[model samples]
Target: MRRDAWWVPQIGAFVVLSSFLAYATWAAFQNAHYEFGSYLSPFYSPLITGDSPHAWFRTRPWFVPAISPALLILPFPAGFRFTCYYYRGTYYKAFWADPPGCAVGEPRNSYLGEKSFPLILQNVHRYFMYAAVLFLGILALDAYRGYWFAGPDGVKHFGIGVGSLVLTINVCLLSGYTLGCHSLRHLVGGYLDRLSGRPLRRKAYDCVSCLNRGHMNWAWFSLFWVAFSDIYVRMCSMGIWHDVRIL
Candidate 1:
């Protein structure tokens, strides 16, 4: 087969996404420095174990001291991303070589589609969306927490730091991606046979449709920012760098 421009992007996507997966896996297991001051890594937000402030609430019976809190929460978001409509198409072509691109030939002679065992699990994307929505709430709360810091005088004050801004932007981007999900759009208004009669639902559908148009952009933006937010918090927590105060 003749090579084309598509290969360039396909290769780039594979490299970048694979690198992220490796880093996330390593970070999740480390389970340290996920929270620094008010900044918390998105990967480990809503922490349920280890050094989490809420650890006294009764840790998971299966929780191990050596394991990272991120191990408990990363699955939901990971599942959502793995089965996302856009991501399915992306990794299929880039990583699986399931047609690679427009004219690229695939090695397999036949396709099983999503009816098979593992692929059939992709059908659970809608359910994952529900969990994803809940996670958005948790991340938003973390971002809110980022805005309050304690002073040397032991007085809590409303202030902003570079990490605070980073966490805030991460939540916003993640919200955009989660809200713009195809399953969410369908849930909002896709079932209606006559949207004209329901102005409210119609309006909601329109809003989601607008967001859906940029789903791919939101996907990449959220992916990078989430990792960046985690790295920023980790650096600050490790005392390798200091969070710059903005307010």
Candidate 2:
């Protein structure tokens, strides 16, 4: 019989998550404005096949449907977040209301405990973790690319732009979140019996632990920055905003 505002955060989470999904889904389908200058939307990074000069592959094959390149790549990163342990708890409470919060009443009494068909799929989270790590590298490269802009004479010059800062911060936040993952932390030292002999492993484990401590903060910040980074690039591409050079 708790009378506190326990349900407040759940409602907040629902609204924030729903909005992100709606915007992300719409942006992925647009296909245009995901790339501007050297800045690339994380959703379309490693742009496998598209019109952007940063595309990792040649133009889309003639036989393939004219879908957005993002549709082809978003799944990997999306799967990572979908199966993330923290996100699992967050969404389960906000979306499913499975005991929504401490002392909260759940809708059903039966518990499957992640052993059945749907919940069992969460076991693939570690694999998705691998993909997330790889994306961090790709995004970091994109951030680096954001710093250079083509001058009027067709020459690229190194300079700081708002997009560059946005991209750099996005990758940094993502890195903190990804690197501190429970899977990555386990990978670092979970198998070892002792840290006495492995100095490097111990050091790595300590680093991961530090980030994991603030995992929730990292998750929220990175999520917001990622969507914002895309908006910045998209607006610059559409001429709604200019990529101002800071330096």
Candidate 3:
């Protein structure tokens, strides 16, 4: 039977996710502190200066050394998986609270089914898996960039600037999403002859399934939030808004 045709909620979600991603992509390229005279950077406030929360980025001629380029690369896999039919069948239906009328595109078959041209791009998940793993390592390095410098008082200080924090959380979220990948889950589960009397393999399968449950939501949320986090840091570095630290 054909899958139900629903389009409204799906379209709404697409719109919201698209808007957030569009603004964030532009923000990711900017300095951490961007400011306007009359108004602060949009959605940020308090105008922090000095070294209370973290050190600021020096306005440089070229790209800043500490910024993670994954800010740019991570979006590719996100866009891919968001449109994947597998996610539409499983995660989007449950967690996204997608209504019956919001099916932007209906699935034609199972994950192993045939693909035609653009639809075949779903296979690109394998390519994205490689990129996601490599970028995770890169983001870890970017997080460590905080440790490269110290405070003037000779204190062992690694500035957890807005950029640093965002990079850290972004990596964590990416890890969660990546772990949820069906390919990775299978890798962890292994291709065994049988599961009979195998406790460890069963345990691993259970763990992977847990992560897989929210895979789609995490994919989209992490993708969008990572970009937004970069924007928050960039605006801070540009001297446009304050990334206020409560602690």
Per-residue alpha-carbon lDDT of model 3 for 34-101, expressed as tens digits? 33222123222222232223223224325433443334343655554554445545445443443324
Q: Which candidate should be chosen as best, given lDDT against the real structure?
A: 2
- Name the top TM-score candidate: 2
Which residue pairs collide, candidate 1?
none
Q: Model 3 off-target regions past 4 Å?
A: 1-8, 24-114, 147-149, 153-156, 159-164, 190-193, 196-201, 244-247
Task: Write model 2 residue lDDT over 1-247, tens digit each, in one string.
Answer: 7899999989988998899889989999998889888899988887877556798657676665677878877888788888888888998999988868889888888888688988999999999999899999999999999998899998989999999999999999999999989999999996778988899999999999899989988988998999999999999999999888898
Count clashing residue pairs per candidate.
Answer: 0, 0, 20
| TM-scores of all predicted structures | 0.93, 0.95, 0.60
- Predictions: Cα RMSD each: 1.9, 1.5, 8.6
Off by more than 4 A, model 1: 1-3, 54-66
Candidate 1 lDDT, 1-247, residue by residue in tens:
6765878878988997998899999999897888898777989867765446535345455535545678878999999999999999899999989978878778899899887987988989999999999999998988988899988998779998999899899999999999999999999998778799889999989998998999999999999999999899999999999999988
* Residue 139 accuracy (lDDT) in model 2: 97
